[model samples]
Target: MYLAKRLSIQLLVLISVVTQQTTAQPLSNKRLEVSEKHLLTDLITEAISRDEWMDANQLFVSSLQAESIKSGELDNLKLSLGLANMPIDSLDFNQEAMTQLKFSVSQMLPRGDSLALKKETWQQKGQVALVQQYQRAAQIERDVSLTWLAIFEAKQSIALIEANRGLFEQLLEVSQASYSSALGRTSQGDIIKAELELIRLEDRLASLALIEQAKYAQLGHWLGDLESWPEPNSLPQVALKQARFYPADPVHFDDKSHLDNKGHLDEKTQTPNHSITDQTLSKQFVQHPNLIELDEKAQLAQVSMSLAKQAYQPQWGLNASYGYRDDAENGMPRSDFLSLGVTLDMPIFSKTAQDAGVKSKQLALNAIAFEQALALKQMLAKYRVIQSKVAKLNQRHHLYQSSLIPQLKQQEDIFLAAYKSNEGPFSDVIKARIESLNAKIQALVISVALQKQKVEFNYLFATSNDFLLGADLVAPMSSY
Candidate 1:
């Protein structure tokens, strides 16, 4: 009766351990709560607000505004005051000596719309600065999202290992009790194996804890010392913006349709169309802030070239002078003299310098055009690569969800049941449990990877239009 009662207690412990292991579920299935989404948004907003790059860009824009204003008005007008035609001796300061105090003002008129072109160039530069600010914001959003996802992945992985560790501990206790009681098939070897598995779980948890800590440190660059920040509770749901050039079949946060009965993507499943024409991509890229930034730079260069070409025209200056003459020593009144003059400087002798300036500006404009073309091609390539990766990750995630994880769970159950009935080795049961745990962790990894790729894919089409107006980046002048 004592042996029978001891056997019944061991069986109950084994059953409890098996039930706990089998009931463990992956964390990937949990949707990001609304509060969590708001938390992520707030983090992104804080990061952007504190970004020094935005402040630098704003400073540049302000400088450009000052230049635009300077070029638009008579800021270059010159004035002079001096003694003119004064005699060397006081005795010579008579009516015929013509000694006088003179004041003169001269205004150099910019040649052929040059002032307008200069103003336009500065304004275009301001636009580029504004676009760059938007680009910085987009980059910040992507970095923060990726870092947060890394933290989430590490946290989830640690949770899975810890949960499985508890089950392993229970199993270890069962093995030790059974071995001591000389019951079931538990041997000293089984006890050693259970202890080894528990130690491995501990090792894994330590490594993952370090990884989570490192990710938090990286996130601190944007969030500023996460000592007070709560650990991320859920993964943010990265939604792909529906851009016109985006693939027709975008992966969604809850999408499961691509998989078939065999846990594979359906042969008929339409993948992202890699054959999107350059023309279509160009249309989209043209609107992207990156390309728009280059376009503004190119426009600035063109205006600069036009301003340089003005050097070929005559430079004109208008001057007016008023001379107040002192009365003659003999008490005769002296007349106040007014003088007006126009000055012209032709570029006849400066052809070489003028041509060089215009050519340099033209070369810069051409360089900007090449840069823009290269940028477009690079963007297209990146989009295709990210699209393919997202599609493949989706398929892998589905395989784990629809087949691999379920099969592993079943295998674990079969092994546990066999061990319970004395038909399988305890080693098989341990192996099955480890396999199930690893598979769930891998599935969570794939989900995180998929979301990260989607973030990049969406960023390919990110624009400044939404925030540009709000930033008050209007051009200083309407026309050149």
Candidate 2:
């Protein structure tokens, strides 16, 4: 009787497990919705809200300006011997000698007064400080934009991978069923391969998740807190939804329309490429903040040279003294005496030192000029490279959207149908699916690259004078 009860219990447990497995639902891609503008606003607001020491570049510049303004006052004249030298007689010896005292004042002035030069030096230094502040602002904008884009790229990659999960599962189901019966077209090896591919996708998703976390941490450093960031899944879904709306070319295969009923690509009118070329970019290069800063630096160096040359000029001074004395032994009081004198320094002996200083300053000015030219050339070269890269990525985008992706999709469908009809190996279907998925992944990579290139151009061109990073305002890469 006990044996019979055990058998009945085992049967019931087996039935329950099979029921759960059969009813289990496949995992679906999570929707991510994000607004670039909103995210940027939040990030910038948080960055500015914090009163950190590192963010005080502008304040430091203001302080330097105040210092320069205060430098207008020169050094005070020397009051030489204001306290008179008094000579006293011996107390016990009682010599008839009378006490005498003397007082004097003196001042030294430059032959070619360089006070103005010194003041100008301070003013130029203030200008340099202001330029440095602007540079810092630009760097901050660059860093923030790069971090934000990195987060976007990682999220998009993970989403693309997730979107293919259903396809992977469907393939796995076919392979499993075919392998179970020797008469089926697919073998156990194909099932194993499908299983491995699924595992690879999961591994890739995990790696992308870690990368996403790191990017969030970097952004949070600027944002002041991680808690303020939206969920990782939220932004990607919005981006994916937008991508779904993006148009792709219609390909005719076997007299059937493979295009999604929801959207269609317009080949006649290409979507405007949001890339900036050297010719189309602003010709007003003078307004670039970096160039402005370098110009100020050069001015500062020139002023320094002028100040150094002032060392060759002579310096002059004046001195005056007064003496009061008591009467002699005859008791006749002596009148107060006054003396005046003038002093001058030709600086003839120090000509070599002054010349050396002037030469040093001149060299510094020349160095800055060379640096400016070199920097400009380098910047132009970088712009050219970035321009070429953007153009190339644009072409690749079209090729993927209009050709490779469509072809792969058709191949996948054909292989899938062939396997179902027992006319092809399941391995072919798996390969087609992987190839199609890879094309999608490649499309995503190019889109993000194009967007990143756009960001670089915006920064390099100084498209916006405002502190806000304009990269956030740009739309995603255009689609056919």
Candidate 3:
């Protein structure tokens, strides 16, 4: 029992120490990058949520409903007057006998099915607008994410380049010192080479900085302000251990390749080895917003056709009124009278017009159906290509991470060690370093491109009612 109590106390002490260490640790670049992604996502969704286009669509829907309501009601209703035997005899004392008065009302009513068809068409149109709005919002979010990734990649290049520049500067100093020393083996040519390399690095840094600025400007265009862009610390860290050399390789120290500023390679490639299948993607293709919008349009055209056919039916109306009339041809008290009317507007004379309208609406519906089918075919083809590309790119990214980068890193370390020991030429070390830098840059570029593919894929596949708006702009990344 005594031992157990002592062990418990020891565990408590360990927990306290760990808590203190954790509290003292600074925020990491990974966490800051996540925060920045969240901020961008929030801004994009907010912009979409407040878009004027959405309001315009909503107003249009309201207008359609209003029109339907107005059409369903009586087209004409009025209080009317009737006068007879007025003022024909001049200077007649009995003018009251020459005057007769009555009051009546008349109205015209719309066809019955016309209002119902309008309501149906309105509903279909509203659905189309809603889907279109969701698609537009998704497009905006996708664009913002792409811009964010671009900026992240630009910043990463700048960091890697700047690190290389520092290395070159140190090497330049060493070469200059060795060249000037009496009895030193380093020649004036080595010093000159180092100076030229340093100058080249400086120029490259300036160019990369400009690229970074342009990327930042693109991000700012979406985010609405350059001043509020996240600080450098909030960017993905390009200096992760992944960018460094691997400690294991069988190569000799004397022979290694160094990377240079010009080692930039195009990173765009296809991905490979995803678990999804074409069959699954095909099943989801019909649910795409563009196709769904087309379906809604078809439904609206069908409703229009129905309304046109309805025009062949007679339009009906009624007029009814109560009248107060003076006694006719007698000096007696007035009597009230109630009158009723029924009017029918038969299409017998305009049957051809109604048939023509029906034909037009039917053609419109057929056109919509054809367009929907075409869109489905096109979307399926497009997604299939994208899937193949993404799969190949995935394979390439794996190759870089698991093979190429580690090999280059080993080469850099080998040349670097030999150069420091003065047993190897400085040029060999620069070559190896440049090669290593190129490998790292290649990895970074491909990583960013993969993320972009993910954004686009999600935009295409997403079908949530809220359309997955305001979600994380990027997946949690460990490094740039």
Candidate 4:
């Protein structure tokens, strides 16, 4: 009677376990929806729409190309005019205006003094132009650098996920082998259930891993090389030394900023550079030092406008001079003369010359005006909006650091010990494993998001010295 009852109990337990296993359904642990990997490069590449940065980058490159052409043209002009042959000091053949300017100034000043003033102006204008070009190049470099950083992050995520999947696979096999052998000591029902759960987790890991290649492909698209991807552990930790939080209108923060920058990063990009950037004239450029170059543009324009009017003015002068024969006894003055004259010249006002002058000034004014307007608009509208959204992310930082990580760690410990015993229902162990994995991924998502925000914050608010690290607004390689 006792042996029959024990056999009946075992049979009933096995049947109930099988029914539960069949009904519970295997849960694949894939992380769906959006996460930081998207922000890293995939989404940013899309959100960063190739507009102004592309245009500005192209503008800087074209500026260089245009400069080369201008340099060639100026050299040609000097050859044609015979101006290059004479030293700048040599006013060998002056136009009516230049002649009058020299003569008039001569009475009050030495010839060297007149030449020095005009020469200084010309050299200074050229200097400003060179400086502007350098800054533009620096800014373009920075844009490419930051965009590529996003690519780096995406690659890192894929590697980490793959590593995690591999670890899970190894662990799954160990758990399965232990379960099959311990079946008598362990409940057969529990062992079978553990086997099934491990299968589900394995499937989940495989699915997640499949996407790793996709992420790798995206990285290759940016860098044109996959093996060149720097090892994940080797990446330099980018630090945010001192972040001066972007102050935004509280009205928008209370209302729209959340809608704009919250929930998803792709949406925040819409705020535009004019909306998101607090691009004060006072705002210094560092990482994207191209902003500094804009000042040089305005400076050059003003100088060119001054130079264009050079032909329009009259110059009057008087000179009292004496020349002595160097070899004469007692250095006797051989010739002495006193001459005074008033010279007046007026521009004939050729529509061509006049029109050229007007057009040049107008174009310079337009460039300065466009850049200024765009910077200001970004600061007031787009950047401010972004700033608010970024702030929200910061507010969540503590929640992750203080609360989530520790709790997940504690759960991992509890589950780890239980699984080793092979005594607990396998479903309990599976639940613990799944929860821990979810928590780990969530932590990564938070970390990646915060890091990305830090990068963007530096990009928006960083000063001129900061850009020294990666400050090429336009890439020289692309230009080449």
> What TM-score, over all chains together, does every model reach?
0.82, 0.75, 0.70, 0.45
**Top-lDDT structure, candidate number:** 1
The numbered model that scores best in TM-score is 1
RMSD of every candidate to native, in Å, equals: 9.2, 11.3, 14.4, 17.5
From the highest lDDT down, the ranking of the candidates is 1, 2, 3, 4
Candidate 2 residue 411 Cα shift, in angstroms, is 1.2
Model 1 misplaced stretches (Cα beyond 4 Å): 1-34, 75-90, 95-102, 182-189, 225-231, 243-258, 269-278, 323-336, 466-480
* lDDT score for residue 240 of model 2: 15
- Decide which is better by lDDT, 1 or 4: 1
What lDDT tens digits, residue by residue, belong to model 4 across residues 1-480?
Answer: 533543554454344323323322234233123243332332223222322444454455445545544433211111111122222565443321222211112332222233333444454454554454444433443354454444344445544544554555555556556657764234556555655554554444444434433444443333332232232332323344233434543323222333423233245443432432334423443233445456656665665566556545443344332221122235433332234544344456554786688678868768897996676556445345555555555434444455666666677667667666754544565566656666655655555565554555445444444222123332222110
Candidate 3 off by > 4 Å: 1-44, 50-72, 84-87, 90-99, 178-200, 225-279, 321-324, 328-339, 414-425, 468-480
2 versus 4: better lDDT goes to: 2
The C-alpha local distance difference test score for the whole of candidate 4 amounts to 0.44
Write candidate 2's Cα lDDT for 212-270 as tens digits.
66666666555544443453332221111112322331111111132233223334314
Q: Candidate 1 residues 1-480, lDDT tens each?
A: 533543554454344323322322343222223266565665666667766667777888889989888878755668889887776665365545468788999998888788888889888888878778777777777788788888889889978886887788777777778778876798889888877776667667656766666666667676563433445777667756544445455443345566676656667555654456768767876877788889889888988899999999897889999998888878978899999999998889889999899999999999999999899999988877776676678778878998899999999999999988878888888999999999999999998998788668667776665343224432110000
221: Cα error in model 2, Å: 2.8
Q: What is the C-alpha lDDT of each candidate?
A: 0.74, 0.61, 0.60, 0.44
lDDT of 3 at 260: 19
Candidate 4 residue runs with Cα over 4 Å from true position = 1-129, 132-167, 170-235, 241-288, 311-356, 379-386, 408-432, 461-480
